[model samples]
Target: MSATRTGGRNGERPVDPEPLPHPVVDNHCHLDIAPYAAPDEPVPVAQALARSAAVGVPRIVQIGCDLPGARWARETANEFDAIVAGVALHPNEAPRLDAAGRLDEALAEIADLATDPRVRAVGETGLDTFRTGPEGREAQERSFRRHIELAQDLDKTLVIHDRDAHADVLRLIDETGAPNRWVMHCFSGDAEFAAACLERGAYLSFAGTVTFKNAQPLRDALLAAPADRILVETDAPYLTPEPHRGRPNASYLVPLTVRAMAAVRGADLAELCRAIDANTETAFGGTWGA
Candidate 1:
């Protein structure tokens, strides 16, 4: 994927900040897509991983929203001790696959990938009303439900991507009986919705968007979320946090968002980092060890 599609639209990667006092995992990132890299070239996975580790973000859950990406993720995880994988057919991709009558085949591939030990989660899957219209919703929902079942049956964590379809996303999860471990990835919900998801034992993973000035509601939700249930991600090279809002983001830039979240919740930065670290391990089952 081009850097622009991965969050490198500005063609400028933000300078790395000082490392955090405690180690933390970037629960969600796309090292393969290299959003925080040059326009045509991905930031090499080794480079991204090293840069992140230098700054105290030692581990990452590499998400692959399609088959090729899933393959990349699995191979990458197997090759690198610092990374784990999550595989799924994205909600937006579902309708297109269904239209081409290939959704089932694609899903079968995802199911097979889900069983791989290095692939700890099934995700970047859920509803996306912002992009897909009513015409594509049925396929999206069908895909989401299937992924949920796959996650449950395989006993892998379910990583969700809800965008402008909060109510329906919650409804479906409730209707299907959510997997034992699930995450609201790049969580974009209010306190009420946070409470709802927390009630279902979902971990809320906040991304750089939480640092936007207008995202106080997100900050409020962060405050509302229990300490042990919170995790942080770059979701890079997108949602770059404040001070670098429009620039390319990377896992190394996670401290900016973590600091913002700490301030919002009136908590000590190191304590929050430790909590998120533990929360991430719990959410994904364990760290990716060589």
Candidate 2:
């Protein structure tokens, strides 16, 4: 539905995981890219939501990191009661648009879209040093600062996408002052970085990546994070969890991540699910209808 040849486009669709004991929201997902990654046919937003609902994932934050995706996110949120929107240009995209001298124009449009009721956050933003090199860092930082300011200006939650740039992300947040509400989407840092983010009142949203055998550090971060400040997401159709690694991810697979989080935190499964539901609402402002 958005973005061409996304990271998700390579895997086969996986079977659904067991249903969660309590309702939870996939704090981040890319409904627009689900079909491109796994199956031949695109799963309509309605079908995707229904599939998730049948399990206990009742809501989702549809993140749009480009202009067209932003439009899709807002429109989809408006059409579906279970969805909300977050808009921004991804860090890697910032330099491309900047080189074309259209960065400001794009940011301006994002600013305009940020005012929509269904648009609950101003992100999928922040530094992504992994994909964006040195020459692109300036534009990424510039775009990040702009998004932080936009979130503050609009009193909306900020969703950050920190990839191999944890220090810079913390620096930028400190320099600009984080919004009242913000989340480290698909948090990939260790306990130290997790502590840093927690110190700044950032919610740590764990994705399926946490279930990887090599993700002990991330699990440690989860263990260290305060219960109220934790969230769960699929980041679909990527980072498919254990038992389904290399397969297409979706909201329905959230239960796998939630279960892993529960085990890591040594908390009750249903309790963790309930906390994730509440944490997601608090992180994104509130439930879509409320």
Candidate 3:
């Protein structure tokens, strides 16, 4: 994701929120993208992990949306006990690669990287109408279909990134068949849409966007979701939670979103945390970083 995509304050990182009552996994995060810092500043992967763990986010699933990112995520997961990797070519990227005649080559590399033990999921791959225009839709759908098939064949969790393309996402899933384990990452749909995903056996992951004042429909979806199938994420460097909504985000800020979710769902904080943790493991195909 681009650092400027979410329109965050960028000057100051948000203060850490109170720790969660129990630990929960950040089911999706882009540790490689540090929008808060400058180009010369190294990505503080270790520091990010420590801060998040201090606030009860002990594990994270680092997602790689392109070639270099896929490699970085794999390498980072191998180095950090608290992280696992998810690899794919983002929907927007697919068109560019296709235009350059590199889409096939890129997907081939993603396939290779995804087989690693440290890589638990194959995605962040799905339709994204908000960014890519009509000209790119075909390439996006083609990529999404390939990633879906790849996930099933490899027995890895399929993590989808649906943005303003919910109907097409569900249609593609129905056409290709959902995998044994899949997630609607950073779920941006309403109660009815949530029901559609849940019916298709998806783990709906709420991100910091859930805390936005304008996100009543998202909150309703949270309330409508069953606890067992719910998950949480930061999608950091983007979608920073409210109160800190226009600021650079990191996993340490996850508690803010989780707390908001509990409030919306009228669920106990600790119980919600526990369910999210377990749901993440299930969504990602078991535990790591023990």
Judging by lDDT against the true structure, name the best candidate.
2
Ranked candidates (lDDT, high to low): 2, 3, 1
Give the Cα error of residue 224 in candidate 1, in Å.
Answer: 0.9
Which candidate do you rate higher for TM-score, 1 or 3? 1
| TM-score (C-alpha) between model 1 and the true structure | 0.96
Model 3: per-residue Cα lDDT at residue 65: 94
lDDT of model number 3 = 0.89
In the range 202-285, model 2's lDDT, one tens digit per residue, is 999999999999999999999999999999998888888988888788899999889989988899999888888888888899
Model 3, C-alpha of 116: deviation from truth (Å): 0.2
lDDT of each: 0.89, 0.90, 0.89
What C-alpha lDDT, on a 0 to 100 scale, does residue 143 get in candidate 2? 98
Please give the distance, in angstroms, between residue 235's alpha carbon in candidate 1 and its true position after superposition: 0.9
Model 1 clashing residue pairs (backbone)? 6-35, 7-237
Q: What are the per-residue Cα lDDT tens digits for candidate 3 across 168-268?
A: 99999999999999999999999999999999999999999998889999999999999899999999878889998777888999999999999998889
lDDT per residue (tens digit) for residues 76-107 in model 1: 88888889999999899999999999999999
Which residue runs does candidate 2 get wrong by more than 4 Å?
1-5, 36-40
